[model samples]
Target chain A: MRNKEKTYNEIVQTAYVMFSEKGFDQTSLSSIASEIGISKPAIYYYFKSKDELIKYLFDKIVQEIQSLTSVELETITTTNFKQNLYQLGEAAISHQEKDVHFNHLFNQYMLLASRDTYYSERLLKIQQDFLNTFYDLLTYAVKINAIKDENILIKSQLLALVFDNITNFILTDMKLDYKKIWIEAVDSVLSGVEHHEQ
Target chain B: MRNKEKTYNEIVQTAYVMFSEKGFDQTSLSSIASEIGISKPAIYYYFKSKDELIKYLFDKIVQEIQSLTSVELETITTTNFKQNLYQLGEAAISHQEKDVHFNHLFNQYMLLASRDTYYSERLLKIQQDFLNTFYDLLTYAVKINAIKDENILIKSQLLALVFDNITNFILTDMKLDYKKIWIEAVDSVLSGVEHHEQ
Candidate 1:
């Protein structure tokens, strides 16, 4: 990485940690800068303000999620669609488990987004894109007679919502066998559709 | 109300507004007292600290939920089980809708619980209680041949989690017709069970 890019990443990384630990309202740019042993002015070069820094972090999070699921989401054969969904759940959990605090941070950012119109719109757009992906996949499943055509819109929304809630379950109860639980949960939702056909 | 009870209620009510508006971390007892036109010492006389006050608030929130769902939860006939669940979701949403900020405040409290062991246990117990209620209903459904007896535990857990997530969807997107969405979501999950039995 170039020197500027490296400095920019350092600032973002430090801010992410501080925001999660102390919370968005309590963590200031100066505190983040001091934590990195840098002057406030240096961070200002990379991020004009704390809000800008947070927006950048949100984009980075979106990019991480996209990269994680892009391969499975793009390759949607009828035979492998259920497997892809299961893999998506597994990938999300394994990635979050590796990071440990990512889900908590993501939720914290969500609360911030919920309060701010600009951030809310940004977050909602990404969520809608995801919902659209699931909707299209379900539409295809219906085409193949994999699922009944009933309530396709709501089922897709429910699946997307469940994906988020499963991540939240990990946050609330670390003892939960979330990967196993998530796979089973997805299986039931998908296979339940197959049962519906009969 | 009695004089002491009235004062206590005032303190709690003021704190709830301030906490939702400014967040838990940013809201102070002194500020709450000031907002209520009470002296700091008077506030201390009722609650020892902000932490104690927060615990009191948590209890109040739990009681509110219990009151809202107690009747539906207690009278769960096999025939009315799904109907009861639908009613519970409706009751929850309508109550939160009445308060406007209640869902946001609840989510804020959840974040606090996620970080603290004491609060996490308190929150988890209530979640477990709700899950058990749903689990029993599903087991009864299985016994009656209303549904298949597969994955009862996870289904109950998923149902409880979806309840939380549906409220969250309202938080993130107020434009959502959450009451309709929630009822339909529950119906599919329950009706999908019947499909499984077929």
Candidate 2:
């Protein structure tokens, strides 16, 4: 059973790389199987179709993100609010970049998912989960008086967008260092919004 | 002469629509001509090829944006920072929606352009123009004491990324109302970063 699960994961990872490089419509199951050095039947046994394969990959990504957030939140319990938020941002960006296939898969997934209703709901749930984490952080900061009280919804949404922009910038290979860029953005957000002692 | 120019403009507009609905690679000159009710030769008369058509369309977009920025900068001499910045963000989002084809062309262009050196220079120039405009705005704001004097390069880059996100969100048909969302984002940047007098 463990061996079967490992093979399934390996196939998904290989499929993600091909899908990102060639696009969904362009990638073929045979090519994926060939790349993985696995038989077509083996892939079919794991995933009924290419669409199902992509969906499974998406689910795994969401699960990984959920786990990452939970772990980070648990570790940051004693840290200052600003440091905690910065760490979260760094972790999210780092995780996305650590695997080249991750950003490509994410961009492709988002572009397709946005247009299709069936996929959009699933995508929205993933987005909401991520946003809820940020919202909780903001709410905590406000409670701790580390940040000013404003509209939490708008604030959370804005922070989410900022992070989105950072991710896109990195994925696009923009001629800027993302680490420096994101760190500065976090500082700007923290300093700009925090209640300053007059 | 005026009639010929109008006809050419109509052809370009029709091509933009078709290209946006059907992606650039998926679109052909024959189809664009058919949509415009013109012969294939007629399209060649206006644009020698599909690449030429894309270049023409991109140049027109850059020109339109440059003109808009110039007009806005000229009119707002007093530097009412927040209002000016808000209006600029509003203009950008509205312009994007009005020229929906620009977004489609841009997305396809990014994928294709990234692989070809021929398109890279033109793409880079467009990006540079955008960055310069944003930097100018940030500089003006800082000079007028509307925003804190900090690293304009990083802030400008972040602002440009936000603008790109707004355009992407609109193109993706995301559920959030862009105008309201942009207003909130701009307000957050302004309010968070400004030196508040207690």
Candidate with maximal DockQ? 1
Error of 1 at A141 (Å): 2.8
The reply for model 1, stretches above 4 Å from the true place, is A1-7, A28-34, A38-46, A66-74, A179-198, B1-7, B28-42, B66-74, B143-148, B177-188, B191-198
C-alpha lDDT (0 to 100) for residue B10 of candidate 2? 82
Per-model TM values vs. the true structure: 0.83, 0.76
The DockQ for candidate 2, computed on C-alphas, is 0.34
For every prediction, compared with the true complex, DockQ reads 0.44, 0.34
Q: Model 2 off-target regions past 4 Å?
A: A1-10, A30-48, A68-79, A192-198, B1-15, B18-78, B99-101, B119-121, B141-148, B171-198
Using lDDT as the measure, the top candidate is 1
Q: Candidate 1 lDDT, tens digit per residue, A1-198?
A: 498888888888888787776678778888988888888999988778878888888788878766664543346766777777778778777787788567667777777775677777877877777777778878887887666787777777777777777777776674566666666656655654663424
Tens digit of per-residue lDDT, candidate 1, span B25-135: 777777888888888889888888878988888888887766654443345555676677788788777776678567677777778885677778888877777667677
lDDT of 2 by residue, A114-189 (tens): 3566666776777777668778877777776777777666666666777777766665565676666666666655
Error of 2 at A91 (Å): 1.3
The prediction achieving the highest TM-score against the true structure is 1
